[model samples]
Target: MNFSSDAAILYWSGSNINLNFKGSEISAILKDSDTANYYNVIIDDSIVSKIQLNTSKQTYLLASGLSYKKHKLQLFKRTEWDKGTTSFYGFETNEKTKTLPKSKSKKKKIEFYGDSITCGYGNEVQNGKDSGTGHFENNYLTYAALTARHFDSQYSCIAKSGIGIMVSWFPKIMPEVYDLINPNDPNSKWDFKKYTPDVVVINLLQNDSWIVNLPKNEEFIKKFGNQKPTEDFIIKSYENFVKSIRAKYPNTYIICALGNMDITKEGSKWPSYVSKAVVNLNDNKIYTHFFMYKNTPGHPKVNEQAAMADSLIAFINEKIKW
Candidate 1:
C-alpha cells in the first residue's frame, strides 16, 4: 500500500503485510491469499487511507509529505478466517529518527481482530447515531489505522463492523467479509497461505450480545448445542477463537482489546443486555496482554481515536522490540 501524499508522519495496521517505496511515493503490499481485504492508512488527521481488494497481493501508494518522525501503525484482520500476515520494509529518508537498523532478514508481522469498533463502523459522520448510513464510508482515521501508522510507516487493516467471534450478529454473514463478502463460495474462495502477521489483536463482544429474544440457557443448548452466549459462553467462544488463531499463527503475539462501549454496564440506555461473560478473559495467558476500557463513548470520535492510537503505540513499544 502507498500513501497519496508524502507524509510528515504516517500510521498503518495489518499483519503478514509489507511495504516499499519508489521516488516520493510509498507502497504497501498485501501478501495474503484472499482476493478481497481491507486496509487503512492515516497521515496526520487530514488524510485517511482505506483499501478494499478483490485480487491477490493488493498494493497501494501514498504521495507527498515524506518525513522522518516516528509514526504509528495499526493493522486489523476483519475476517475470522483468511487472517493475513503483515510486515514493514522501506528505506529511511531521515537520519534524525532512529530506523529499525537495516537487516536482510524478514521482519515480524502483527494483526488486529475485532468487530464494528475495530472496523470503525459508526465512527464516521452518519445519518442518525443508529441508522447505519455510513456503512460504505470507511473511516481511515479510526483508532486502529492511527495506531498502526504510529508503530510503522507500513501496515494494513482487515477489520469489519458488526462481526462476532463465534457467530456474527448479522445472520448469514461470513467472517471473510474483510476480503470478499462471498469469499467461501465456490466462485470466490480465498486462500490464507499468503500473508501472516506476527502479532494478533482480538476485540469482540458487543455484537455477540445483540441477539434479540434469546432463548433460555437450556433451550439455547437444545437449539444451538450450547448456552445462549451468556458470559461464560462468550469467554469460551473467545477462547476458542484464540485457539484457532494460535493454530494458524503459532509464534504470533495476541492482544485482546476490551471494547469502548459500555454494553456490560447496568441500567444502560441501550436496550440490549450486556454480557459480562468474557470480562475475566482479559487475563488469560493466551493473550500477550490486554487493554481495558478507556471509558470513551460509542465508536471513538477523532480525538478518542488519537488517544487509542497513542495507547496502542505505547503497547507496541513495550511488548514488541520492533
Candidate 2:
C-alpha cells in the first residue's frame, strides 16, 4: 500500500504519525534535506529503529521480517526543526494499511533541554569504542523521553549533540538559540505560547565545563570574543539563561540538572553554580537534581538511560506530584 498527498505533511518537533496494517514489511517515504534529521520507528509499542533522514526525497525501509499480522507503527521526529524538516509522503506495506486515530493529549507535559546525553548520543554502541555520529543516536529512547512516557506525559526535547549554556563545542550556546524554532538559524523564533511544559529540565554545563576549562580551546575562545571567560563568567551566564527561561514560563517548574558524567574535584563545583543560580533567582518553584556519575566510556546505554529515567521519575513524582 502506498499513499502520498500534500495533506500528509507534519511540521514540528516531536510530531508523529501512526499506521495500522497487517504486513510483514513496511517502509516510509520521506523527503529530507541536508541537515540530518531523525525519526523513531516503533513497531507495536517497542522502538526498533532510529532512522536518520539526510537525503533528498527517498524511500527508507522501516521494518521487515515481522510475522504477517495486524501491527501498529509509530513514526516520530526526534530532532527539532533546526536540524531540518522532513515530510512523511506515506508508508508502503505488503498489505493494505490505514491510518490510526490520533492519541489523546496527555494531562502532563515536559520539556527537556541539554546536549548529547539528553539526545541519547551513542546509546546504541555495543563496542564501547564506536564514535562518529547519527545511527547511534536515539532521542526516542533517551532518559527524558522515557521519563515522559513513564508518566504518560507529552514531551518536547530541545537539544543538540554539543550545545551548552555558556560554551558549546562550537559557537552556539543554549541562551542564544533556546527560543529559536531552528537552533541553527538565529532568525527562527519560537513563540512562547506554542507549548508550555509543566516541568522544564535543564541538563547542561557538561560541554561548557569541558570546553571552557581546556588550556586552549581556540575555537570556543574565539567565539567567546571580548568577554573574559572565567568561572564567574560561566556562573553568571548560566544564571542569566535560567532567568530568561523563568521569565518566559513564569509558572513552570524548573529543574536544574547536571551529570551522569564527571563532577568531582575541580569539576565538582560546576553543579553548585546551577544550584546557586536557582537560589539567587529566589524562586520556590525551581529545584536541582544530579545523576551519579558511573564510569562509562561513551554515552549512557539503554539500561543506563533507563536507570536515569527511573531516578528522574522518582524525583518528579516527589516534586511535582504528577
Candidate 3:
C-alpha cells in the first residue's frame, strides 16, 4: 500500500481497512483506478455486501441502521491488481457516531505467494465463463485467507492470476515480480524485514502446467526457447524459487504446495517436481504437499476452495507447531 498521500493506495487482493466505531451508519471516502475494482463490506465477521469503485472520489455508503453501540467494519479489497487499484481517504459516520481508539496487538504472520487460487478468482461464479467481471472474484474466500483467519494470523499475499514460477500467461512470472511492492513496477522493492511470516505457503505451478503444454504460447517460447522445459529444468526452477524465499527468511517454515488442479492429476509429474525440489534442498523447515485434483474444468469454486482450506488447515495443524 502507498501511504504517502492522504488517500492510501491499496493494490493487492485482500488488502483492507478495519474500523471499530459506535454508530448507526458509516460511509467511506474512496476512489479507484476504475469501475472494475470491487470491495467486500464485512461487518463483524460476515460479509454483508460487495462494492465497486469509481474514477472520481466519493463517499461510499457501507452500512446503515446499526445497533449504534459497537461494530467492527472491514472494507476489504476483494478483487486483484488486474481489477484496478483503490485509494482510501478514510471513513465518515453519522453525527452521533464516535470512532473508537485503534487497538493494538501482536499476531503471528503468514504470507502466501501463489496464483489465481490464492487470489480467489471466479470463486463466486457457478459454472460461469473462465474469466468474468470482477464480481466473481473474492480473495477473502480463498483457502489462503481461510487458513489465516483460522489462526488469527496477520496476512500478506503476493499473487496474481495466470502466474507461475517459471512462466505465466503473460511475459511476467512470479520470480520476476514477487519482491515488488507494485507488481507492474519492476523497480519497486518490498523490504522483507517489515513483515516476516512464521509460516509461508507457496501455491503455484497450475499455470506452468498449462503453459508448458502449449509450445506455441508466446510466453512459453520466450521462456523455454521454443521447446518444452525438461523435468530437471522444472525441478531446478522450483528449487531456485524456494531458495530465494529461504534466503529472505532463514527460519520460516516454507510449504511448497501444488495443485487442486490438473497439475496434480493422476498422471501428472508436477507434484513430483515439488517433492523432488524439497528433497534436493534437504531443508528441515521446508515441506511439500499436493492438493487433491478437482477433476473438473475451470478454477476451484467456493465449496472446492473450502475443501482445500480444510485440507490445508489440517496439514498445518499436523506439520507446523506455530
Candidate 4:
C-alpha cells in the first residue's frame, strides 16, 4: 500500500504509539465479491481518512499536522460481504521537515499473533447489529494496532479468526506450533521465515475450547498428525514454539496474552498457563505479560483497546527506562 498526503506533517516525541485496523487480513481467505467497498481510517477519535484501491494497489493521503504522545488509527471496511484481505502501513513526519528521522530508537517493530479478536472481527454494527452477518468495520481501533500507535512503533499482525492453541475451527490448522497444518494449502508446510514477529503476543484458545466440546472436567489431548496435546503436550508445544521464535529472533521479546475471547471458559488456558511456564523455563530471559478480558460482550471495545495499550506502555516503561 502507498500513502502520501499534501497536508502539513504531524509529529510526536513519545516512545509508544498504536495503529489499529478492523479489515486487515493476514491469512488469505477467498476475496469478498464486493468490489466497490472502501476502508475507513480514524485518527485519535476524529480526522477520518479513507482508503480506496487504485488499480492493483491500495493508497491513502493524510491531512498533516497531527501530533500526539499517543495516536490511534483505525480501519473499517464498508462492504456487504463476510471477509476480505488487506494490509495497512503508515509513516509520520514533522511539519517543518519534509521527511522523518532515521534513528535506531525510532525504529521498533511489534508483531501481534492471535485469533479473531486480534483480527478485529465483529467490531462493526450494521442494520442494528442483525443485518450484517460477517461484516467488519475494518477499523485500526483494535488493541494490537492501537497499542503500536501508542508507542509510535512499526508493526505487523499475523492473526486469524477461530484459531486456537491446540486446534482451530479452520481445517488443517494448529496454533503457535511449528510446521503443523497449512491453511493456505493443506498439503503444504508453512514457512516461518516469510514473516517473523519481533514482540509476539498470542491470544488463542477461544475456538479450541468451543470446538473440543468435551466435558469440562475431561482432559483432552491435542491430536496433531501423531501427537496429542495433553497438558504436558501443550506445555511442551509452547516451549517448542518459543524455542522456534528464539531461534529466529534470539533477542525478541515474547508476550503472551490471555482472556481476550474468554478461552478460559472453554478449555484453553495455555496462554495464561504458558506465561508462567515459560517464565520458569527461561527465568529472566523471557519476559511474560498477561492481560485480562476488558468485559466487552464478545471482544474488546475501543476503550478496552486503549487500556491494553496503556498496560503495554507501562510494561515497556518499566523495562526500557528511556
Best by TM-score, which number? Answer: 3
lDDT of 1 at 235: 56
Query: What are the per-model numbers of colliding residue pairs?
Result: 65, 0, 0, 30
lDDT of 3 by residue, 58-136 (tens): 9999999788688888888888888777889999877898989865644788899999988988888976445646888
- Model 1 lDDT per residue over 1-322, tens place: 2223431111222332222322333445444444334555544333345655434434555334566444433233322233332323333333343333322333545566666666555565443243233333344556665666565433445555666555554442324343332323334433445656766666665665554235543333343564454545545665666666666666657666655665434543221211223244343334333344546545655555566677777876776655
The collision pairs in model 3 are none
Rank by lDDT, highest first: 3, 2, 4, 1
Which TM-score value belongs to model 1? 0.55
Estimate the TM-score of every prediction. Answer: 0.55, 0.84, 0.97, 0.61
RMSD of every prediction:
9.6, 4.0, 1.3, 9.5
lDDT of 2 by residue, 1-322 (tens): 1123652544344567777777778898888764467788899979887887756777899999988777788898765444556666767765454444555677888998888788777777788754435556666777998998898888877777778887777777788888876565677678889778899998988887777666467657676754547676777888898889898899999998887877523358887887777778899999999987857676788778888898899999999898
Greater-TM-score candidate between 1 and 3: 3
Per residue, candidate 4 scores C-alpha lDDT tens digits across 116-142 of 666566555432231223334343656
Question: lDDT values of the candidates?
Answer: 0.47, 0.76, 0.88, 0.50
Q: Which numbered prediction scores highest in lDDT against the true structure? A: 3
Off by over 4 Å in 3: none
User: Which ranking of candidates, highest TM-score first?
Assistant: 3, 2, 4, 1
Q: Model 2, stretches more than 4 Å misplaced? A: 1-15, 19-27, 34-38, 48-54, 61-72, 78-85, 90-95, 223-228, 264-267
Model with the higher TM-score, candidate 1 or 2: 2
